[model samples]
Target: MIQRRLPIASASLLGLAAALSACASGNDLPSADTAASQVTTIGVNSYLWRASLEAVSFAPLLQADSAGGVIVTDWFANPENPAERVKLTVSILDQDLRADALRVAASRQVSQGGGWVDAPVQAATVQKLEDIILTKARELRRQAIAS
Candidate 1:
């Protein structure tokens, strides 16, 4: 009875391994016939890229590079708080719609008499901005899929 169980377990394990190996195999895309479909791709996920641009459109842009998947903004001063200003950087790390793929950094400065001084930024501010970007990305993706 023990010998019979051993064979069954071995067969099951072999089947699992085969399935995983098949999944790991890459698509045969380099063939001449498939060259047209293999256009160059942007470094980051498309939805996230568009959404990040839209979210920060209010701020003046310093640099935007789709191939590098980075967006840097010029310092923006709030009308209500003329003495404080903030600059934002958005980095997209992967070509997938995942929370870990997006990174948001903010730098805050306040006027100290005549010179601008760096100020400690609240963690919540960064997180909230990330959430907004993610939400917009999801919406954009959904719309794209529907169309």
Candidate 2:
């Protein structure tokens, strides 16, 4: 009889420990409503995202994903340079509006034998675009803060 009571007491202690641990784990997790409230318009900086779109609006947009913070533009040819065209891809890599968080890649193509051929894109071109976008993003952020 004493042995049976001891086993029951040990089992009860084990169950209580398990229950306390479960409650602790639950406390560490956020509720669904809390997560929903934290959602934003974009994954990266909003000022940078909007400024990037405005800067690239001159070109035809092929894809834009706010969640992924990527913008791809279709090949654009200038009337002055009918033989050469450029395609641009912009990536917003961070939630902060920092220079390292923005990346610009340009693809250049030149007409060769009535077909488009890949050409080396100048590093300066990509850097200039990035600078322009960053400047615009800073300006937008400033305006928002002032207002």
Candidate 3:
């Protein structure tokens, strides 16, 4: 399954890059009315998708499906705290750039007795991640418009 998805993910990233470059070249800039939101050639808002990827980029990705608007990150243990690890899943639920269009879920684990054990993730952590993604998405939209 991952082998099949590699091509699709690569193609999607290439398409997004091409689209963004086109936008940067001032050939396909959206009008003022639609520029604030709804800049998407894929299944979800390109800005949000890109922002989510950037937010979790420090971790290894397990799956990324642009058509399905899902990004799953493999377990990541911060260098400062190897005993604790986290995995993230981000879902882009809409084609428009809106606060409700993004969802972030996290699973946490802590090392116990030389073994990993599930730990509860704080609600604020999830909310903060969503906020970061949304902010970056909005910033990307603004830059796209400015360019």
Candidate 4:
């Protein structure tokens, strides 16, 4: 009886895995391509980014190049200290707004230091949008820092 159950159990497990993969892999996206290439950073949307991610922990996302200077990292924070226990949805978008390497975004983050905060995140869209916002934010930040 156990031997016979193995095949049925295996089949059930396989089906469940397939269904999950489809959803988790983002295969059902409307388009893998979006307005990513044209994103230009004007300013940082840090607050919005944080809010978006607090609601949804998303899969990995990406972007291309930008025409601005600085990039932004969005992370959710505890109301007490917004930046304290924050979960950052980091982006590897350069001042140029390009995010080619998928892993690069994860490697670089505002959360490098130890903390009790989880890696704050939103859907991949938060990351994609950050590239757009950061191109400009980076430039502004650079200019401000220089001043």
Best by lDDT: 3
CA deviation > 4 Å runs, candidate 4: 1-76, 80-84, 89-120, 134-147
lDDT of 4 by residue, 1-147 (tens): 999999999999999999888978865756432234333344323322322233234332232122222233344444554444332334333222333421213221233356443444445745665454445544544554456
Candidates in descending TM-score order: 3, 1, 2, 4
Candidate 2 lDDT, tens digit per residue, 1-147? 999999999999999999888878866664453222122457767777888899889889999998888999999999988999999999998877789988999999999999999999999999999999999988876775566
**CA lDDT for candidate 2:** 0.85
C-alpha TM-scores of all predictions: 0.72, 0.72, 0.76, 0.21
lDDT (Cα atoms) of all candidates against the true structure:
0.85, 0.85, 0.94, 0.41
Tens digits of per-residue lDDT for model 1, 30-60: 4453222112267678778888999889899
Clash number for each model: 0, 0, 0, 13
Off-target runs (Cα >4 Å) in candidate 2 are 1-40
After superposition on all CA atoms, what RMSD does each candidate show versus the true structure?
A: 7.1, 10.1, 18.4, 18.8
Q: Say which prediction, candidate 2 or candidate 3, comes out ahead on lDDT.
A: 3
Clashing pairs in 1: none
